[model samples]
Target: MSQKITWKDKLDFILFGWIINWAFPQYYRPKYHYTRYRKILLINVIPQKILGINRFVKWPVHFTSVIHSPEKITKGILCDPGDNPGIYIQANNGIIFGNNVGIGTGTKIISANHNKEEHSKHDTTSPIIIGNDVFIYANSVVLPGVKIGDNVVIGAGSIVTKDIPANSVAVGNPCKVIKHNPPHREKFTREEFNKNIPKQYHHYFDISSHE
Candidate 1:
């Protein structure tokens, strides 16, 4: 014989329905949803159990600086998703970030530029793409149409005016490639790399002497 549906089961079903309605009311109404509240809580609250601090510490500040098309900004795993003073992301087109991307405090990424001749009009709006294992230091500005490649390090207070190639360290007011290969990874031997890295991360590094 099948088990009878108790009043407790009915109550659980009602609670579940209520939660869904409360979280996603956009399905029924045409109003601005408080979607970021859930995201903020997930970023701040859940991580504290394991990390002992908020994972996205600057999420509140970052959320306010996203001017246009905030939904188009996509970030990857293990990323510090925000800035301290705040980073301006005018994602009118889109901004795509790859895995292990760390954006430092006070970095601004402008995806749209105004016309030089006509100040009132927009010149062009394009996407900004930042690749995997990239670190953009504080107070740097990435202009519209800039594409930063994988395994790149951008120095502090630099202004990125054009596309940056992979596996380079760039710096200056208008950022320039100072080194072909970043010094940090080049200096380490396989044994040193394995020994220095945590046990969980040892699999990512090759055991051979030559990288």
Candidate 2:
């Protein structure tokens, strides 16, 4: 004997099908703008874990974007999807991101580049490895074969052309390290964080607690 499928079960099935469709390139290529619709659907379907939605929805990414090998890209918890302009990832080799990695708007992490000698030919592809608790700001570009270490912060509108060591703040066109051991709030507790918050924003926090 088999049990009847409930309404919840049917809904679950539909959502699962939607996710499967999003994962494949063929379905979304024709309707690239519809990618935003899928992102909204996922947010509505699951609200409790909205902050960590990117891990499942993979939003802001158009279907046309090439993810040559899905298995090669390893993302971690609380990973944010690219912002409005979205991210462009060319993972011919592989790209690994550690926990709490935040990729900002219009960011592109490319693992392969064209060869200098042969303009038509691509250079040897290399893997991009990002360590835990890294925050890459908006409109930044990380070039091929770069490794960013843990607790690193990348400023907006910078281009990374080389490997960045851990616990440093890097910025500029060539992305030079400007400071070491930048201040981070990840280790602070909720109370501690609130205490350190600027006075102007305190009123907003108060209102939020009332709600």
The candidate that achieves the highest TM-score relative to the unseen native structure: 2
Tell me the lDDT of model 1 at 166.
Answer: 90
* Model 2 regions lying over 4 Å from their true place: 1-39, 42-69, 80-84, 117-120, 187-211
**Models, CA RMSD each:** 14.4, 13.7
lDDT of 1 by residue, 98-153 (tens): 65577787888888787889988766666899986789999899998899987899
Using all chains and alpha carbons, the TM-scores for the candidates as numbered come to: 0.56, 0.58
What is the per-residue lDDT of model 2 for residues 1-211, given as tens digits with 9 covering 90 to 100?
2345456545543555455344421121112212343453454334312433333434333332223444567665434334334667766678887655778777888888888899887777668998766899988999888999878999998899999999899998999999996544443222422013334334423423222
Ten residues in a row with the worst lDDT in model 1?
25-34
Task: State the local distance difference test value for candidate 2.
Answer: 0.60
